[model samples]
Target chain A: MTADTTYKVPTMAEMAANGEEPEVLFWVGCAGSFDDRYKKVTVAFVKILNQVGVKFAVLGTEESCTGDPARRAGNEFLFQMQAVGNIQVLNGYGVKKIVTACPHCFNTLKNEYPELGGQYEVIHHSQFLQQLIDAGKITLKGGGTFKGRRITFHDSCYLGRANKVYEAPREVLQTLDADLVEMKRCRTKGLCCGAGGAQYFKEPEPGRKDINVERTEEALATGADTIAVACPFCMTMMTDGVKNKDREDSVKVYDLAELVAQAYSL
Target chain B: MVFFEQILFVLALAAAGWFLTRRIGLIRRAILLGRPEDRSDHPGERLNIMLRVAFGQKKMMTKPLVGLMHFVIYLGFIIINIEVLEIILDGIFGTHRLFAPYLGGVYPFIINTFEILALGVLLVCVGFLARRYVAKVARFQPERHREMGRWPRTDATLILVFEILLMTAFLTWNASDSLLRERGFGHYGELRGTVGSFVVSRFIEPLLSGLGDPGLVAVERFTWWFHILGILGFAVYLTYSKHLHIGLAFPNTYYSDLRPKGQIKNMPEITKEVQLALGIPGADPTEPPAEPGRFGAKDVRDLSWKNLMDAYSCTECGRCTAACPANLTGKKLSPRKIMMDTRDRLEDLQRGWQKTGPDFDDGKSLLGDYITAEEINACTTCQACVQECPVNINPLDIIQQLRRYRIMEEAQAPGSWNAMFSNIENNMAPWKFSPSDRFNWADQLKQ
Candidate 1:
């Protein structure tokens, strides 16, 4: 799908200035905000949201990290600092519903934030897409670009085992009319992308192989032409893994949102 | 002679009961050493979970073959213990087959069922032993898993061998007693009549047929004593061995965390500090602020009681370690080892307390002395280990707590992590990007 240059994204600050409140606040996580590769995913998601006419506004510059990495790395001090800051911003807007494309952000905002007095009805993008599709708002083109293609969904640890949101992403994938295959370890037994617990920031402890490499091998073993992911961390790790095996030419990694956008020609 | 035998049986039973209770009490005390946690909520849900996971062995069924075999052994062990009740009554009253007269024809049917289960237990124990020693399963191998060192490996082997021996004695006692009934020798001949031979043990009868009536009585008496005494000894030994899971698994599964696995527990203490720092205003002015305790777990005592109970409940089955992404990738962090170390540290503290009262300091801690920073840091917080555990034990909670201690208390996080921490502190993200530019990605869409 070609990039839509005329799409104007609204920020929470701008919306509030107009005495407006969106149906849901889009939490653009650190990766979705700044990572070069993940920027495309953000655009694709925005395209889909705009096409569906969902009233969603971004926190924009007001958003901060959900402190998942800090908390997982055992720095509760830094974690609460970032968490409380974001919670205040979210509360200031009186955001009652939130949607994010990142599992780490989704997990923190949905589960961890409530205990810190930042309760919001949070849903991941995959679940949001599934909801849209279920509500007949997202009708795909029959036998579209991804029809009958082999697509394997890598279960992000935060999304699958951690939060038990296994079926929603796969439910979203089912709409593509694609052959959804599974890795040997999928769903509850899914392997990590080797980027959790702040492992993304540092070298892995000496091991026989990196966890992402091992997980990538599992995905490659499935022989799927396209790898579908819902989390940005999995996007980076699995993309690196596809590159490590030099299979970038033969295989492609796309976020669930990106796949939907491409299939819809949004 | 029967009176003397009854007295000996009573003495053995009393000693066994005393020691088992004492050991169990010690274990209870050790588990209680950990900090308080309110897992008491959701009683009805906890009971359902306990029933499904522990009683139903639901998670174990994920691996059908192993699960079926384990189910056989578990069912057999429980059913066979019913026969122990009969043995106890017969011992105390100096009666043979005490239930035989009360139940009439149904007694033989019950004995046959016990015999069949005993045979099943015997065979499954042998199969487990072979799986551990002969086939050398990867999870059970000391060579592959350092935590399966001499003591742990031997403890597993000993339990299996003990079960096999107990089953052997049970079957032999039944076989010889049935033979003696046929011969009309002593109590077996006088009291029991010709209540038909048990189904499984009848096959064993021919082997003891060559031993005459006197030899038959000797075999019957010897196996009867051996079977009951072995059961008594095993009951006492159970608290000291990894086999304690047979009992603790129920309570462990019952009190497990019901929250989403992604939710790392909120530190209210840290929250208060952060709220105060940010001037968020929730602290009560009327009450003097309590002194802040340790940030995270440095010792077993700092861990929640559920964590310590989880350690005691671990079967050391290595399912957690086997499924761990970090462990599979050859990292030093084995979820099973984390549990084992917590248990070992608790036991060490328990030993010290016993020697010099409860205040005794062992000068050892669970964090540094047993588990290393390298091990705790390797965890991906993936929850694979948590998912794989059949009894609902969570190794990730302990790993995170130890990681918290290392980073928050000792300030010993890795160099790159420190950099990431500072970056998040200043930039509101883990990277050194300006928060004002968080929406800069939108510029691409406007092109």
Candidate 2:
């Protein structure tokens, strides 16, 4: 459950150097790499993969942006310029399956990459974790850490509407034995945290209120102690909303992987 | 006196033809003002899409009640136009019920069928009018949507009211002519078959019964003139109204994006540039080292012809905005507004060209003057708008084009976006960090 000197994590480059291939490539997205908060989610997911003995390797230095922001921001040229580079890297490695915690990356890789001839079995972490749970490869101890806790899962736009992975996150939540309350707008009709379409990087246009603030108010209305998220963007936006509402101390935002990790005390 | 009537009919026909042709020509020119795109591939798929979405009304069927009403209106519009053709021929030749003699018994049947359709059209138009004004369907009211305000509401109401008047005129013409026949007036008796089973006219017979031959003739002539002129006027006015969708739906559905809704198109030009930069094998070389051109669309000219076609094809139904998650979440973005803004800007551009030639620089564009960065940015790119569009119009395409112009051309993206852009350019990711540290998250699993 903790980092030790003798433990080793392999990179795709290192695995290829040793004439080997992992079962899947763990795409540590930008936030997973550098964002302090999302890094914990990334580490938790990695620990689960390690515990389940799923052989996964990081692309490390070879990995690049999927160009989701570039494309969404309307810089198709930059996006393609970025996508083509990443596609070359993935194709060069003959990567067959990819797992990522970010829905944006999952969407771009699963949907957009195929057009540029970089096709692979791309699965979101929530879905992959569900698969692990289904296969009985990972088990929760007793009722799990979220047992009887009032938790509301926020549907990330990319994961929910863009990709239609509504059930997987909910299924993962079900395994926690938590009181999974839902906001008024959930699933297909879920309100966005106003972070999609590269909006996270921009100040909102002169609207009466920010979209995240509106969405956060809805999540808070659920009266759930925990606001569970599956995407880093949603996490950041929801966390900010909670702080703005002065409910940061009362309502905590945890990535799905964070809950799963906490259940195992990893 | 007969000769004068004949000349007036001829002149009216000529005027209608001239104006309709001019309006259509303007639309063609405006559509062509956009950059060329090759949507010529997949003939079979395009045809199938046209038949299913536009002709079959597949998308509209999702809301069965509204869908049924729309189907009735659509069917009436198409089937009733047959009578318009008959009117056109009769108007030109100055013949009374010209088609009636050609097919003796079938003439009555045809008229009866036309009457039924005209009645349907009337009812449906009334229902739509009530939905807009009486019940005030939230989507139809301009007050609920700033983009749709007064002019759009008036435009919609005017068209519906126009249809009601046109149908009334036709039915009145029928009733008065039948009355003339009953009175044994000149040529009215011998001109048409039976006139026996006039469904709508039979009910209207009481109103026209009091008018003698001269009075009947006057009523017939007035209704006749109003009906024909209304048809002509409607045709001309459609080019300026959301009703242009009647003419545009077929082509818009045909050219609609057949790709999976989830797939965002990649720029092939940029792909080639990146390939050469990455030193990929067999990549095209000596193609003039890629210099960045306009990164995204700035004006109507920068958008593809299909996008411009979509603008023209928009029905202003607000279905897209109604389904939009951004709009539902109270964001400023509305897919309907995007199409409206695009169409309005394109019209402005067309007018500018007409006034000052193609080289005229009004210094305004589809981006800032019409659509704003805030609206475009608020989109979740959920494709709810695209999915809900009955005619297959894609507002996301326009939004993306405008966003591209903002980021790539104007460099007007927010500071945080600029930082992310720099991060991607330098570190090959959206985070400002070294690639060597990417696997550090996995190190936490060490035991």
Candidate 3:
């Protein structure tokens, strides 16, 4: 299993090998840059795209914050500035469509930027990954009947609620064949991990429940030995929540990238 | 003389009523709980908001029953103040029988009923206080020191002591009135006839017999004033205190927003043609019909008069942030902050207007220096905060206004933003896949 998975948007053939840059650009969001390892998944993402033969290009570090923080802070000016700047970069690249490993970035770029004049065809990496899986380009290693354990999945607010992305991850998990139990508060009503909205930077305070930890407790109640995460943001927060609950030995956090990459095990 | 008492009571109440109504109106407006605009835009949202936002309830069928129960008890407060109007009239005049006729002839029953209810509510409040202070439920952190969690013990003591004082006043009024009516001046003798009669027959009767004194009549006369005076003091104490809402809630609820759901009122539109003809702030000020770019709620005076009313009408319920998906998700955007900002701005304007100096035009606009772009974009536009707001102030309107100023007027949107906006502006779609591609995913015959 690859320890470092960079869940980039484009396949290596499109990014490096193929030399055929499509109209679409992949936005590797900030959190994905810092924590998402198992870069093999990006390779897998590339593998799926190559098999499916979709046209796309990779844009790393070229994209920045979609000014989500600024918008929440009541500073539309800075958000607009961010939106305009990002649009210029994307337009300069002659990019028309995009995909991403990060849901938050995808949500902002896809849903909000049009208001500021930056609009592109944006989608989550899970969509492409699922498409590749459906085509039988590559079968998942963890696919089919993982026993001796029960696991729950935490659907991120951004992916689940904001972007309405629920099916792709669940489908990925079902392929793993692990015993999947749902967190009571899953899907649209899924609680937050107290890490979004740039809250990871601030100190935890009273009355502010750690949505991740609270969610973790719910997962733990299901007697799950592992918690699968779809979004990289959910990955990092859930990792900490598992540790905080001292369930490191009992329960564990797995990035969908890492989990999917495991399916490629020889 | 008897008619003078009733008329004097009525006039004094009328005066208090004016200021009271004004306060209620201002708060309701500021909270933005006005009736719906189109009335049909969002039925589901309206239902959920009414159930969750207004009642501080949630869809428990989806969430955990435990959490749901906690919130209900946390939110469902039964306010028992049947003596509200009577209390006010009693304060206005030096009368103790305030609305005594309306309640049955049982004085002890009336006093004991509210006293019991207040105690029960206090018990519930204590549980909430304990949950906040002791158990430290997630999302219970107090943003300010003077808030509930700061000095939990002291705050609890103060509230409990204050409630005790109210109960104590009733107790004293009952005891003293009983003594005076035994000497025969009280109109209602419910409590006095029971407890006081017993005490008077045993203790007071024997004492009077021993004195054989006509001066005992003077003592009873003094006792009657003390009974009326005690209730009067409670009245004045309540009106000037936080407990004032005990008298204000019904009026506040009645004047609440009864409009159609989810529709924000389109702000005042001025004759834009004149402003287009001759630009002042460089464009048509839409409300005043000036230049096009003249926005940011215009002058401090341009702020909705309803917003001004919110400050006085604030119930200090923190439900706005509680239901705020952003706040719960860890964003710094406090729905309460906007309300507080409006209040601070109004305070500043009030002081500035009083100044015998130059009228400041560019200190801090709500859409300008005070708030930032980061805060605005972070919002998921979930409307949880808006729905959760008991008073119904629309922060979304303010956010959209700020967004309008930034994108349309300032021309400061980012690169990705322009990529997104230009695509939509030119193609009328979020993506550049072309209009025909929309049908590529659609198959009419498949259904």
Candidate 4:
């Protein structure tokens, strides 16, 4: 479904040229920008922002990777090179707040950037969505699509144990009125989807089973038909995991943004 | 003569003290061999964390049953050691139950509580041994964790067996002492008779009932000697065993990383180089750059002091390895093994330093010789291991440093990683997509 012609995504450059400033700069991370599946999440999050009448601008082409993968993979030189470049562009825009759908970017920008003179009030979109919901700015229909449906959220390590945003996403999901079944391992004990630490870039070292597959088994054991994820990396891993188990037809993996967008019919 | 006995006790005390002090000094030196980073900030917060995690055994309670058993042993071990104070004073001053006159009613109560805790410690130690050997808990199994090889396995069993023997000696001594007191044998009868039979040890009194008054006195004295000597021996052996956690856990938890688990420490040295290359406004173009230090940890010495301390603090519980996503999926990396290898390499260096000099090189390093590239690569940096550790050890820090070393210094990263790195460098993303087309996903909105 295409949006009306009135809907236009404002770029930071365009906003600067027009002498306008949005409330928050939406950081469409590498996956949110380039990954075909994760692009939908970016679109869904944008739709939610528009529906809620929240003024937001995207960096578009000016935004670069936050160097999370490089730093995690131990290429500190390359990581810092990317970090400084991104920070300069961010500082150039005078961006004061950032919200992102990617946990990796959220973590790096919120925690790692301040040390190198790049600091802002950065937050994961899950936390942002929870705030909106709590503020009563966004409301779901009485009989939303996810009502009573079994949904198990796969905790993103960067967001959960890393930053302790375990409840924000779950709280957002609770607004859908869906049955949130918990995996045996949840919260601090939650299993990784195996794509973290740049493991997504390379094949896993030979092992009996993939880490994502093991995590998927736990998710499936909860018997939830819908698996929810907060991070783009977890989305790729868990989606691939479902396809690997030949349960793609039965189980669907959706980002929290996508679920919220769909639930509200944005 | 009592004089000779006193002299012997003093000699044993001096020897134990000397050996423990020497070993502790060596450990401190070895840990200091690592590069320094300040973990001394927020003393109040660190104290709170140490109190909760180490003293309160907070994280261990994640597995309630096992945590309770561990709490029993820990509480029993600490409380029962109070009795040793009396033993030591009695040994040096040639006094039998010296506190009995002053303590009066409280003496029997304290002894009764000690007896109960002693029984708890004995039972829990046996249960722990059974969990390791009989039930074959997955975490403790050498078959599951190759790092639990013969010596590590033997080290654990040896401590358990040692504690069991010590507790047995204590109870048998108490039982025999009560019997001798009833017979008013020599010095045993000198007490105000206020310290009655201990609660739990009374059960053992039946076995010693068949002995004569002289035999009972000898049994009491021998077991007393055995119990005290065993404790002194255990203290020295602690420095050499994984049981060092009994002492190191306090400091390790106190200095734990207080930042978010996901926040990997940034390298200021690297940041300077990056700033200079980018010609950032604040970077001094005319000034000469600082000499480059090693990028990451190539050996134990290259790691931080906290990382080295984590190795010594590790109890070899295998909880980290058990929680590791890589190890759970059969990958080669085990967080427990990483800590074990670090400690082993440090010890190797310590021995070499003692034999030759501080500058002596062994032609081996922790990265290549102990922990292999494959093991560190398999880590997902999930922080599950760090979260699972009861003592707040961060194995992820060491793994990340080693990864940094492998990639930056050795340039030994796998082909795909190199490709990804180059892609991120040229394309501004991990994949080979053009940055110009970043907004393509938004085209649908305009349509």
The DockQ leader among the candidates is 1
| Predicted model 3 interface RMSD | 12.3
Q: Candidate 2, residues B205-230: lDDT per residue as tens digits?
A: 89778877898899999999999988
**Model 3 DockQ class:** incorrect
Docking class of 4: high
Better of 1 and 4 by lDDT: 4
Off by over 4 Å in 2: A1-9, A40-54, A76-78, A114-117, A125-155, A160-190, A216-229, A239-266, B1-7, B98-113, B140-144, B191-193, B278-281, B290-293, B322-333
For model 4, what TM-score does chain A reach? 0.98
In candidate 2 chain A, where is summed lDDT lowest over 10 consecutive residues?
A1-10
TM-score (all chains, Cα) for each model: 0.98, 0.86, 0.52, 0.99
Question: Whose TM-score is higher: candidate 1's or candidate 2's?
Answer: 1
Model 1's TM-score against the true structure: 0.98
The Cα error of candidate 3 at residue B319, in Å, is: 7.5
Instruction: Give candidate 4 misplaced runs (Cα > 4 Å).
Output: A1-6
State model 3's lDDT.
Answer: 0.52
Cα lDDT tens digits, model 1, B112-135, are 888888888888899999999899
Enumerate residue pairs that collide in model 1.
none
Worst 10 residues of 4 chain A by lDDT: A1-10
Q: Per-residue lDDT tens digits of candidate 3, residues B1-447?
A: 445755755665565556556544433443343222333445565555554543443433333544454443333223334555455556456555665545545754655555455445445556656666677654445653223344433443455455444444433434444455565544434434443433212333444433322344444434433433434444554432334443443333333344321222322222133224334233434545434334334223444444434433343445556655556656556555555555556545544544743364446766555556555544444444444444455555555555545654566555455554544334323234343332221121112
Summed over model 2, clashes come to 1
lDDT of 2 by residue, A1-266 (tens): 54442334678888999999999999988888878999898888877887888998988767778889878887776787778788878988889999999999999999998877789999999999999989998787767577778999998878876778899999888888899999987886677787888877767666567778888999999989999999999999999999999998899999999999888887
DockQ of each: 0.88, 0.45, 0.05, 0.87
Question: Residue B318 error for model 2, in Å?
Answer: 2.8
